[model samples]
Target: MESKDLVSDDGRITYRSGVAARLAGLSPETLRVWERRYNLSNVERSARGQRLYSAEQVRRLSLLKQLVDQGHAIGVLAPMSVDRLQELAGAAAGRPKAAGPLKVGVVGANLARRIAASNRDGSDLVVQHSWSHLDQVALTSPLADVEVLVIELSELHDSALPLILSAARACDGAAVVVLYRFCASATIRALRAHACLAARVPADVGELLSLCRSALAGDRLPPAPPLPTSDLRFDEDALFNIMASGSGLACECPKHLADLLLMVGSFERYSAQCASRNEDDAQLHNELGRAAGQARVILEAAMERLARADGLPLPPGLIK
Candidate 1:
């Protein structure tokens, strides 16, 4: 019944379906489809019949998603082992040989200068031009000439979603990369929904270069599908029975929930700062962000279930 059984000998972490989905840049329903249709991995089920995945399994799923994005069929890739999948990914990535420095356009002058300076060797990628605003990119012509368009934003806002989408469309096939200081799960979801790529602020220039190369090579993952509505049926009688039995007091569910919330919130802020200050730590920070986001989702769902069972309305902004 222990979820730790899903972990591997190397101490790789285990994740339930929701966390696995987020880690693999997929939806839970899509994971189910891949498992049911192609038997993608030897997924383990928890005592409660929930799906669990290991870190290695998530990595394989990510590779499969990347390969499928690059025009490889899922049926062909699904049966392949993780090593084979990685080989294919490497091969696809290797196909893009830079005849000249890959042309990159940036929406922020400072980011553009940083990337340009980072590419002093002039080998892999180059920042060709930079605009102070997204509107300037629209005013300019010959958008197709740019291989990649990089947009740096201070924060992920609801208003910026359309601008990012429009910028991507304007380029007419140029890969879009969004760099932001702070991002929410909803914002990441929105960016992916529009087929644009995103990375946390202070992202490594090398990684950004690699992403651009992949994008130019036609490596594009499909947008994740919307999550299915929960059909959970709250058991009010059982909850009351538990309370009547005095077990609820011993459990201290409220105190435990508050502690969890505080820990997650604190980690989230710390991760954001780490992401902003250290380029090398950006990936880890982003992972932490996703984990915190998933935790929040689960906690919110639990709160909603509790409210429903108690016949009480949840606090404003709690569910959203």
Candidate 2:
């Protein structure tokens, strides 16, 4: 069903599967599985046979996801009513219905202001610290006592990875939410691998708040898949030869090729450090592997192009 179907003249609001998934912090596939296996919610079918969910159902699903993240078994929570589920969650947390506000540390002033404004009507969230840059969070660990850390960035750059990692460490077990104006797929994947939640900018404040709640409740998604490395074996002599040939190429090819090579080399060094530190499971390591894999592809293509330009014989393995 299209998103337009979310509103009706009867004053009831419904959401399609995609919208529901976003609200509930679940994938559409996971929602379908829940519907088929656990009968978690009463989903309706659109005229085109697409799934539709009511507002209450979405809330239940969000609560379920949060509970599951808190280590509650889905089989137990799925069969219970929303009130019962809330009671159980509150009991598990050893808190009253109206618990104290969550302490939050925000990295950007604008984000801090927006969060403050959003909570003007009252919410169980408090902004304890605000910094104009991530560097401050990394250095001062101002968020060390907060329950959650929210960082706002214009873009996700390689240089920012260390700062993010350091902030995560300082915050102890606090959940992290990274809101970016623009981010690459690799960067998103990397952040997820490190247990950091990422969201795009221009998002609804409600959704962001929901994300924060879920994160604080321990509802983190699985790590991204490891980078493909089956064909990434690096041959020292072949790479040296390619660089030598690329250096003599006309135009920008030489510079681009050199940059790619340097990037790959840097990634390799970073990966080695991660392994030495026993941080092979860390997000930065996986990101470095993915970056190195990408660089290898470009470097190989450049080598092939240089070989064609020089009329040199191509290596059998590099034919593709």
Candidate 3:
């Protein structure tokens, strides 16, 4: 594991963990921490089960480490696309970029400050203007170049609708989000009638940012991925019973399939946890987790089909 070894598997060149860390200007331990915390990708493993990083992954780590060295947080960068990370690194080096993060204007003072601080080490969305209240924002204000406007309210009612519409007009139709702690369903429906969006106060600043991104993307965002099941189809006792019943069979395939399903299902749960830990990486981790979940389901179905063919009785809960 400590050797500076190079490997090529499946025709994709790879580097040993140590070699990758060194090339990326990172210590081996830091790389391990990032891997364990972020679950960056489905990392490849050597024949001995030692970790190996693909060439592209090493290059990405080098970019990430460079940015981290310049004071960026690994948590924020871990969930970003390579192009986004490259853009951040180039900007840090005083190099120009094609474009920047989505510009967002917060109409609430407290929310603005919180978003700006949260995004200080992140990419994708930026806090542009922070007006203390909706009344303070107008047509003559810094409305230009503000792609989205986020307004926060403690309570929302019918009367406030006019002023909110006025603020939206002032921004020249920039997509608006009204985050309120209290609101009626009818009021939310009315707001949406005018091409406006409304939601209750987000549980956290990260949720707020995700809302902004999704609002702007609108129909472009893909449907939400399915979460892995907290309760697996087969319990330990059931799986053990199945294995015991398969003892007289020609092979131990049933036990092996069950073991593989358990491992894959666990990874599915872990990937979902990683997605929740950081919004930046949520999309990537969600996709990975969903894929694993789908695979687990397929494996379970195959085991059931084969078991039935071999005259094995599945647990009651597992039957269709």
Task: Please report how far candidate 3 places residue 254 from its true position, in Å.
Answer: 50
What's the C-alpha lDDT at position 167 in model 3? 83
Q: Rate the local accuracy (lDDT) of all candidates.
A: 0.65, 0.68, 0.71
Which wins on lDDT, candidate 1 or candidate 2? 2
Residue 84 Cα positional deviation in candidate 2, in Å, after optimal superposition? 27
Give the Cα error of residue 148 in candidate 1, in Å: 0.5
RMSD versus native structure for model 3: 20.6
lDDT of 2 by residue, 154-269 (tens): 44555587898898777776788887654556677678667677776534456777667756655541133556556653353454344444444456564355445644654554
Clashing pairs in 1: none
Model 3 gets an lDDT of 0.71
State in Å the error of residue 133, model 2.
0.5
Candidate 3: tens digits of C-alpha lDDT, residues 1-320 = 36665657557778888889999998989988999999875778878897888878888999988866543456668999889988877765663222557787778646765565557576756776778878777745547777778898745666678888888777777778888755656777677666566777665577776666545543110324567575466654455566556555778888788667755765676667667765887888789888888898788788778777777768887667
* Candidates ranked, most accurate by TM-score first: 1, 2, 3
Candidate 2 wrongly placed segments (more than 4 Å): 1-100, 221-320
- For model 1, how does the per-residue alpha-carbon lDDT over 73-110 read when each residue is reduced to its tens digit? 57657889999989878976776654567888889745
Whole-model lDDT, model 2: 0.68
TM-score of each: 0.43, 0.40, 0.37
> How many pairs of residues collide in model 2?
0
Model 1 off-target regions past 4 Å? 1-100, 220-320
